[model samples]
Target: MKPVNKNDRLLVHVEDLTHDGAGVAKVEGYPLFIHGALPGEDVHIHVLKTLKSYGFAKLLEIENASPFRVEAPCPVFDTCGGCQIQHLSYEGQMTFKRKLVRDAITRIGKLPDVPVHPVKGMENPWRYRNKSQIPFGMEDGRVVAGFYQPRSHQIADTDICIIQTPEADSIMAGIKHKLTEMGIEPYEEETHRGQLRHVVVRKARATGEIMVVLVTKKKKFPQAAEALKLIQELVPETVSIVQNVNPEKTNVIFGDETITLWGKDVIEDQIGDVRFEISARSFYQINPEQTEVLYGQALEYANLTGNETVIDAYCGIGTISLFLAQRAKFVMGVEIVPPAIEDAKRNAELNGLSNTLFEAGPAEQVIPRWYKEGKKADVLVVDPPRKGCDEQLLQTILKQRPERVVYVSCNPATLARDLRILEDGGYRTQEVQPVDMFPQSTHCEAVAWLQLAE
Candidate 1:
């Protein structure tokens, strides 16, 4: 190791916790985040960069180890950026996730009355990921596939990812080898003329059938057909193959053109005996097992009695809306994306569900329009995107005053902010639960049930 640059050096011990990684000690009464270190560990850190309030660092040594600290299994633990808490014990990870949600509600959202239960961790953390999105990048002048490194734009070449399903890992060697053999050009960010962008894989746990979606920058994905054939030959259990073209320069995913190469354009999966059809662009929880539990919790909080009408706002492909329709008199799902709404209707019809309906529009707009016609939604379930509910949607919900409001959020920071608005609008937080959908990562999903405040 190179000798220390003392000019930037600042030693500190971590005191509390941050959602990102490790918490840090106060140096001269200023908090400095000590990376690669665990809580309750005293460590000497070299401050790399200083911010206005806090600073970042690299751990020089661990003077004391936290009880929760455990050696991460993967070689790419800190580098790949896929999982952050691999160094943390499974039990401790759950504790940290729960506390983070509680703290977010209490401090960030300023909602102290709300109670957040201990975050639920997976039974078998490894092989839990049923879905994988592998980006294509050039390495050593050859096309390669793997996940990107932590907080960086560069993609790292790795074959084995411990978190995904066994089927996902099985096809890795073949996919990489074929992509290299075909000499498919990797997508260059500057030119945006590459034939390969990403290789998305999904597997149904119940059926053991896999679906591979090839994402390219251009429409002519001749390599995808050859690659899919090779993948099928290697693994015949692959039920379907699909392709999508993403030409946008931005990192955000909105597959510009979707084409199914073989089999079905949509993949099928079951959650708690209930089957669901998900297209390539549709949103389904990456972790299927945990999603069942989450839906159970949301349903419990909803207190549905089989006689009420439920409206699932921001319902992507009717996952929850269709699930609730089985019990409720009628379930109506609303989504902004047209493709997702179409998928929801097809899924509902495929499952022989007749009571649920899906529409395309903003929730705020839909909720108000429905209210004008005197539609009494006894229960309203909202599964919003990361940004959380908008102001107009909040106002519409309050005006309608549904018997119960179930708000499921992926971003706790935004969830907390929206909860405050709900509280101000006379809605009381009934319960909040956190689900550790993505282990080792800093992000978490939270559900907040609200009703008219007394």
Candidate 2:
């Protein structure tokens, strides 16, 4: 019989944290997940819902708070779904992330002996994000813009987001106010009857260049000129103002056509010594400073001596390929997105790099063909999506037999699973380094180095 019921108020002790940053407390071995609660704390809670084996609870009161708990800085921390662990101290966040990685590697991968190092955290974690994609909606006949409410499409209206750069906040405020003043209706998802859909702002930290992308339901934005002028006046760092038309009635933020309403089509940004031309759709890392650190760790794992070949699989815009090309004999990068490959080629040319080649195809298919055509890689680096590397790619890595492998991951459970596959395929994981790319949030990026066994 279940020990908890709906509307049951009970005192429980939080024992651990879930991957989504929810506190886990067991009532007679039946786990209950509570938000706004941390591990090692006693809290009074009301059961909201119950399932076959688990339940969800609302934190009524923290009878005994953990030392790591701190006041969340953001006003909408509870309602906004952007950040999950804002109430936890930064120090506690780092420790939790490290344990998050360690536990995944140990439990999921079943590799208990693997060395999981401490997370490399930022000194000032606030306002570190360079890109912001905020959705706009109407509430009470006023245009509202901010992050979506938790698990819903409702926009939590706010002018400031502490994680995004100040320029993004300013640009969003200006655009929102201008849209209201210009009688532009915010796009309604249910009816699909409005004009503006979303506003994606990218601010280059290295160079104070900013790109403002106005996503609308159609291309006939008659007030594009005024919107551009307002953004330019609001922030002097504005370099590009573009309009992306998404006529579909779907949840996707962008659509097929992009028109440069004003300014340049692409803005310039730098990471390490490599400069990149970021467009409205480029997949540049949101956190540039930590990106350098993550890429640097991958570069170090490669241990290039300018006499070996490297293959960067799932390469987006040649970020890691360009980083490795500076030291390797040659580097070949492949991605499934053709436009990303074009951007990669453009970025390579922009950086005056000639030894790197990027192709538009799946890493699994392209790499095996490369191996068959006498183009084998000495080092293979993969930075895959949250689902981790494809099984075909893992098989390709084993067949190619690279001397070293550097796996950069944004999801730990998938990383652990992939690492186990590589370990069984004759590669020994040297170490895994966790990098806190998104602080005050549960997300963490890790880079693992592996060597082929003799």
Candidate 3:
């Protein structure tokens, strides 16, 4: 017999939180997932949909609230898809993130002995994001700009977003209004008509330089001179105004052609002592402060002796490679993106770090090629994406057998799986440190330290 049915209202206690910030409650051993509900809470839910194994419920009332629950600061926090877990306190968020990493490493990696440290959190987590990607659309014949609604393409129009930088908030509001006043049409995905599609704003935390990228449906921007002037007047700090053209009716944000409508083609920013020039499409970290901390942690885990060679796999823009190059004798970086390799080389030159070498190719392919050329790394570092390390890269690491490995990961599940593979291949997992990179959201980043077993 099923414990829940459509339209059935029941009182339940939330025992845990899912990775996506949903509350988990069990009814006769059947699981129910309810959004906006926190752990250690009693709630009334109306069953919406039921599957064979689990069910979905809508939160109707909070009979008893958890102590960790707090009033969300963003007005559109309930409906906007930008952030989850905003209702939970900052401390609670960190604790939940730490638990997330701990559980994955323990259950998935099968490494119960490895210690997972508490999440390294920021002093003030609000408004830390240096970049904002806002999609523009039309609603009721009016220009709308903001994040999309949960699980839908409908935009949640807002004048302010608390998580984004102050400069971006002002830019989004000003640009949307300027577009509306100028009678420029917002992109309509249904009809695939109109001009403006998205607005991307990036602000350098250290330098305060800003870049505004306008993604349009076509190359011909209406009133280009007037629009650029308005944008400059609106955002006085903007150093770059770029236009990216995308004619296809696709969901992708960027197109092949990019034009600099005004100012420089790139903006400069600094992470640690290393300076970098970021283009409109460069892959720079959104949270610069935490990135410094994360990279510093990886550098510490490397335990460089000024004589060892280090290899940075999946190094984008030479962030980790340059950081390690400052201490190690030589650092080599491998990236699949060719432009990222170019940017990395330029960044290395900008910092006058002559010992770093960056090559564009798959890390799995490039590092092995380097080994054949009589080059080997004493310490290997990998900062892979949410998908974690590639299987071929892991096999290469096993074959090369670096003395120490520093794994910087965005997804703990994949991190755990990869770490298990390394552990089985004669590497001993030492410890894992979770970093709260994205606050007020369920996402977490971690750095794991491993050593070849003696």
TM-score of each: 0.94, 0.99, 0.99
lDDT of 3: 0.93
lDDT of 3 by residue, 225-295 (tens): 87788778887999999999999989888898999999999999999999999998999998999999999
Candidate 3 residue spans exceeding 4 A from truth: none
Backbone clash pairs for candidate 3 read none
**lDDT (10s digit) by residue, model 2, range 144-236:** 999998789999889999999998899888878878788788999999899999999998888888999999998898887788788889998
Ranking by TM-score: 2, 3, 1
Q: All candidates: CA RMSD in angstroms?
A: 2.9, 0.8, 1.0
For model 2, the superposed segments whose C-alpha errors exceed 4 Å read: none
For candidate 1, the lDDT comes to 0.80
Q: In angstroms, give how far residue 201 of model 2 lies from its true place.
A: 0.6
Please identify which of the two predictions, 1 or 2, would achieve the higher TM-score against the true structure.
Answer: 2
lDDT of 1 by residue, 203-278 (tens): 8777777888877777776666677778788778887888787878866544777888899866678887568887
